[model samples]
Structures are given as C-alpha cells and as structure tokens.
Target: MENTKRKIIIVGGGITGLSAAFYTKKYFDERQIPIELTVIEKSPSFGGKIRTLLREDFIIERGPESFLARKMPIMTLVKELGLEDELTATNPQARTNYIVHKGKLHKMPPGLMLGIPTQLTPFMKTGLISPLGKIRAAMDLWLPKKKGMEDESLGHFIQRRLGKEVLDRITEPLLGGIYAGDTHSLSLQATFPHFSAMEKTHRSLIVGMLANKQKPAPSIAGLPEIAQKSMFLTFRNGMTTLVDRLLKELQTEHLITEQGVQTIVQEDGGYTVHLDNGQQIQADGLIMALPTQQTAKLLPNRSSIQWLERINYVSVANIALAFDEKEFTYPLDGSGFVIPRKEGRLLTACTWSSSKWLHTAPKGKVLLRCYVGRGGAEEWVQLSDEQLITAVLQELKEIMGIEAQPIFHEVTRLERSMPQYPVKHVEELRKVRADLAIHSPGVYLCGAGYEGVGIPDCIQQGKVAAEQLAAYLEL
Candidate 1:
C-alpha cells in the first residue's frame, strides 16, 4: 500500500507563504495526519513587503507601516502567537489629515466617508473645494441611483455621483492613494464595493454615509477620540515583529530563502517544483503564495493567464527622513497629508510617522516618510535617490517650510509591486480561478494580487489557502 503521508510545498516566503505554511502544519497536526511542508522564497529574507529598519532611534518601515486593527486576521493571529501585549494602536490625538489643493495644505473636511462629504456644515465650510464644486457635489443628495450592476471605473462612479472637481480633489487623492492607480481605470466593485451598496440601499451616497455615521461605531476603552474611527495597529517594535514571530511557529529548515522556482511540472497524483538551484522538490499539493504574473510563469497553460499578465502594477518609493524636533518651524499637527494629482507633486502622500505612532521615533526627534510615485507619476521614482530626496525636500520646504537638512534619510523603492485592479478585475480573476480549477486542482493563488493588498488580507488568504489545500489532500 502507498504511504498516506503527504508532502506540500508553498512557493514564496513572504507573509502569505509563511502564514500558509504555519496554518498547513497546524491543520494537519491537529488532525494527526502525517505531512511534510516546505516554503521557498526567492528573496534573501521573509515578510515580502514588511521590512523594517532600526536606525539611530527610529523604527523606519521600508514597506507597510501597519495593519488595520479591525481586519481581525492579524489581530487574531497576534493573540494566537502570544504577541497580543505587543500590539499598539494609532495615536488617538492624531486624528486629522490634510490634502494639498491649489498648492496649499487644506485640512480634510470632517465627516467624510472616503472623500464623500457626509456632514453638511463641514462640507460647506471646507476650502478644499470651490463654490461651484461644492454645489455640484451637493447634487449627489438629489441624484438618482446609477442604473447598472456592471463593473464601472471608480473615476466614472465618483464623478457621476459627486462631480469632476470632487473626484479630482478629494476622491482622487483619498481613494486613488490607496491603490496608487489611475481612478479612471480602477474597478469600483473590486476596490470599494461598500459605496456601490450604499447607492443601492440609500439611493444617495450622502444619505447613506450620514446614516452610517450616525449609527453607533465600534469603540475601544481609553482611546475614545479615535475609538470609533478606522484603527490601524502595529507592533511596538515594528511590523517585522509579526514576521519574526511567524518564523518561530514554522520550522527554520522547512524554509528555503534566496532560491527561485524555475518551473512546476505537473504529474500524475503530484507536482514537482524545480528550483533555480538545480533541485527538484516534489509535492502532492502546491500553494502558490505569489503574484499572479509569477504564478502564470509556472503553469502549462499560458493562454488562461493572459489576463494575469495584463494586470498592471505601479512602482513607488518610500523616503524616510529623520529630523530634530526643533527643526520644524510649524507644529507638525495631525498624522500627515496627501497631495492631489492636480498638484503635480512628486509626493503622493506624506506620513508624520512620529506623530502617527508614538514608538516610531525616539523623544526629541521626528521621522517623516513620504511616498513618491503612482500610475502617472512613475517616472519620479526612477530618479536617482539624491534627486528624489531633493524633490521631496523642495516640496516639504514649500508646504511646511522645513529648512534644516535631515540628520539621516533612507529611500526604498518597490518596483511594479502594487497591483492595479482595473475595471472587471474581479471577473477576470474569477475566470482565472475557474481555469485553474479545471487544469490545476492542487495549485492555489493568493496575496496582494487577488483579494486585497493589505497585510491582514494576505494573512487571511494564506490561512484560507491552507484550509482548502488540507481538505484537498484529505488530511
């Protein structure tokens, strides 16, 4: 009789892959099923985009700074890993955010449900919009519901309901900043499905937003100011703490870093993962915790993944500058500010890291990080590091008048890393999944490509993939 014990290999050693390995081991261990697991990562390190650096007295995040606390996956995982005590929420006092309009920093109006003004008084008072623009946006209260279930571009939906100025000014910077993609091509259903549901349920986004805002929000003790607000939490040490803890749960020997997967040849009852290192790893089941394009390369049917290759990505650079607290002429109020595309600035957004998170910087020092690049602004990131810093500093001088040179600076570029979910992205992914189901049953895809780009989303994807593959192996 054949051995019942099964072997599984997970491609990629990032958060998604790590979580998949952890859960896969946990699932089979709980069921008392003999299983062997290996995780392959081409990069030298794990965590994919979750790199952190401790320089001087600052905790500089080369990638994502935090995960949404309300997402539940990361939060739950933290508790499970016994790191619950290390969790830290965003500063409650850092509630305000700014948007640069007409080359001036304007305070974002309160009561905004993702840039759609919900409160009448603040919306009318905000200087971010012109008199006519405000009037045009007010028309959303009276406009009929958009009549279609078809996937529509986010730009068209926002402009149709709120008007062009609102789209360019508030919605573009706020929503477009999230995906770092052209709103004209971004999918509304794939990005912000809640807005679509709002139109269907309330007939008007403004009404829906107001109704939702009035509903009692979730709260946390001792952080009443931001208790009901969207909470983004991170570790006291940095985002890397999560990755380091995950490694503890997974055996070090099972993880192979700095090794690339050259090919995946499917065979009867199993699959073979060939590494660039002249080694072939065989497995009964495979989990591809990689980007859609990378996964396309390993499959036999390239035609099915034509859409995957076409899924666009944008590059962005994170520039972290450390400055003495006294260097700032003006008070660094609020968390930070975002620049509208109309402003034509190198910086898409800037986060006052020190203010947003208390542990990010030591006392008497500040760490400010800015993102420089988006879809149309891709050329900016290609600039030399010095050139990019100069441009960022110039913008800072003009906007905040900070003249003192940074004590230290770090620039990290993520080339074509952020996936752009264009119109019909969800439908295209559905077809990809269906095709894979027919052609490759043991293979699974997840990460920033399909469901979401956030850390929590990736974690959830990894866990779900493990559960699905475990059942497939009948473990």
Candidate 2:
C-alpha cells in the first residue's frame, strides 16, 4: 500500500501562519513528502492588522508603517520573494525624534538607545532632565547591582538606574508609545533581555551600553545598510507588501481565507479542527498563530489557559492625517514626538509619516500619524472617528503649532492590539509551550503575544515556528 500524505493545519492567516504554510510546503517539496497544508483565517482577507491604503498616489498605512531592517528574517523573506527593490529607507533628516517636556517639544538627545543615554555630553546638555535629575541619572554608574530572582518592571529598572526624570520624561513615553503599555507593569527580563544581561554582567545599564557600543556589531543578511544605523524601520508601501508577497509565492491550494476555526479535538494520532461554518479538517500537525486571548478560546482548560488570562492586552487608536506643507510654523525636520503621560496629553505619540518616508506624500503635502489610548487610556478607543481626528489634531496644534485641517484622515482602532509583556512573561510562555507539548502535541505558537512585538521580531518568530513544525512532521 502506498503511504498516505500527512496533513498540516495552521490557524489564523496572519504573517506567522502564512509564513508557516509557505515554509511547510517548501520543506515537504524538498523532501518529496506527500503533505497537505491548509491555512484558516478568520477575516475575508489575510494580513491581519496589516493593511495598505493607496489613494491618489498617496500611500497610507492603516497598520504598521515599517519593520526594523536590523532584523534579518523579514528582509530575507523579502529578498527570497523578489521584493528587494520595493524596500525603502526612512529619510536621513527625520532620524532624530523629540519628547514633550514642560509643555514644549524638545529634541531627544542623540546617542541614546531606547532611553539609555550612552554619550555623556548630549545627556547633560538636554533640558528634558533637571540638574538634580541628571545627577540622579548619572548615579547609575555608582549604584550597586540589584540582586533578585523576581522579575522587575521596566519602571522599577529605569527609575533605579536612570532616575524618575529619565523614566517619566523619556523612557515612559518612548516605550509606552511602542508597547502601548505602562512601564510599571512591563517586564524587564522578558521584553528586553539585552538590558537584563547588561545589568547582570556590567552591573550598570549605561556602563554596559557604552562598553557594547565600542564593539563591532553583528552581520545581518538581506537587510538594507540604512537599517543597521537604527533600531526600527518600515516599507515605503506599507507592511502589507511583505504579507502580499508571501501569499503570492505559496501555492494557493495550501492557503484558505475567510474561514474561522472554532475548535480542535484530538483524533487517532493527530487532530481534527472544526470550523465555525460547520466544516471539519484533520491534520497531522497544527500551529495556532494568534494572540494569547484568542489562543485560549480555542484550547482546553489548563494551566496555560490561566497564564493566558493573566497576560492582559491594551487597546490603541491610530489616526493618520494629511495636511498642506505650508500649514506648519515649525519646520518639519525630526521624525516626531512622544508625549509623556505626566504631560497629560491627549495623544501618546506622533510620527511624521511623509517626512519619515520619501514618496509617502506628494511634494506639497505633509502626513502625520498619532497614537492614542495606551494602557489606562481605553476611552480613546470608544471615541467617534470625528472625535478621534479632532483630539489628535488639537494635540498636534498645541504641541507643534500646526492648526491646518487635514486633507485626508484615516482612523484605525485596535481593541487589545498590543500584548502586555508583564513581569514573568517568559515563565508564562515556557509553561504555555510545555503545556502544548503534552496536550496539543505537534502544535506551535508564534506572533507578538509570544516574543518581541516589532515587525522583524514577528517575522523571525514566524520563520522559526515554520521550521520547527516542518521538522516535527518530517516534511
């Protein structure tokens, strides 16, 4: 008798699931294994939070604008899929960012890596910190190392090392903008392992950063040379391009859209997935690539479910506005600004989209995107589109002295979009994986909920999960 082909099912057709399907097909094709792959997505289209809006030669990104080039997996996949040329770097002039301090926008001093100021001269000259604050922040060099087995919050770590001014004025707004999380609840060990290692090794975060800066950086393939200069990046077209290319390359038979998975049951030696529309499919291996809350709804009750409940999520609203270039009094030079919660601002952060990426707007137009409703700011999510636009514009006018009405406006409200990596996040993930090994055998998990949240991080996680699942099935 001829051997039957093994079947693989991937739930949630986001970047992670799509990447898994693509790699699974490639792996089986290389091995000459008879394997059937199926991808189920809840939405009518794929690219779950990633959507590109093209209107009147203006490319608007409703989701993430870009991925950091330093991360290798996404760029490598881009090259493999023949999209190397479409990649565009941010404008060199827009590299610098600003922070709101005492009702004014102040340039974030250069030589600072994610709130840890490395260069002393720039750190001392910045008005974001007071003389006392500067003294407190510099005391990190002399402060003894903190020894504790318990996980520390980002707030505690920065305040201990760099003082409250650094945390409130700089670190809070920058990190809070990115994570949509309160620094007090964010875990230092899980979210940023490098910083954790720095403390463990050099006893001072600043000292470790300066020491590491002197050493040569590692080589990252397929990434653009410009990405090596910074920690973040995005495409000129939008993040959806990456997803669209992946879907295009993978065989259509292996991909499924508009199919919502309802439940999973163990069968013979594999598993059977039941769809919401009363359809069933069996697979030898399965991967659930979704947020923790979404994953919990599909799994059986266990310790992992409890951990999922413990892992909370926050909502955010991104408002994109377009205005004429002549409307602003201040020159639009820097990347944008982040508003500290202490400043009591309506918006969290704003990005100068047109300035950040060339060709994002026509020669005479300006584009900006504001982030709102992070952590305790859930009320912003419930605001009407007009209300959201008004709030963001009002804040921009107050902060940047721009009072022009937007020529075009786009609002995207994400209810529980960003996952909170609270203290003990790593421990929780380890337990979740262990539970999967016992209950949902031959299953994998990936996405922002598990690892890093950046586009590069998610791409790397997706690729890693794909390789692991393919190897498990011998495909």
The C-alpha TM-scores of every prediction are 0.96, 0.96
Report the C-alpha displacement of residue 391, candidate 1, in angstroms: 1.0
- Model 2 CA lDDT for position 16: 75
Q: How much RMSD separates candidate 2 from the native structure?
A: 1.8
- The lowest-lDDT stretch of 10 consecutive residues in candidate 2 is 221-230
Q: lDDT tens string, model 1, 192-291?
A: 9899999999998889888898988655433323223547888889999999999988864388999999999989868988999999988999999988
Error of 1 at 463 (Å): 1.2
**What does candidate 2's lDDT look like per residue over 1-475, in tens digits?**
0277888888888777777677777777787878778888888998878888987667888878887676677767777787777777878878878999988999999899878999999999999999999999999999988887678898888998999989999999987677888999999877777887898899999999999999888776555666677566666677788888878877565677777888888878789999889999998888888887888877888867668866778988788888888875568787888899999877888889888887788888888888887787787766789988887778787888887888889888888888989898888788888888887778888888888887767777777787887777763
Tell me the lDDT of candidate 2.
Answer: 0.82
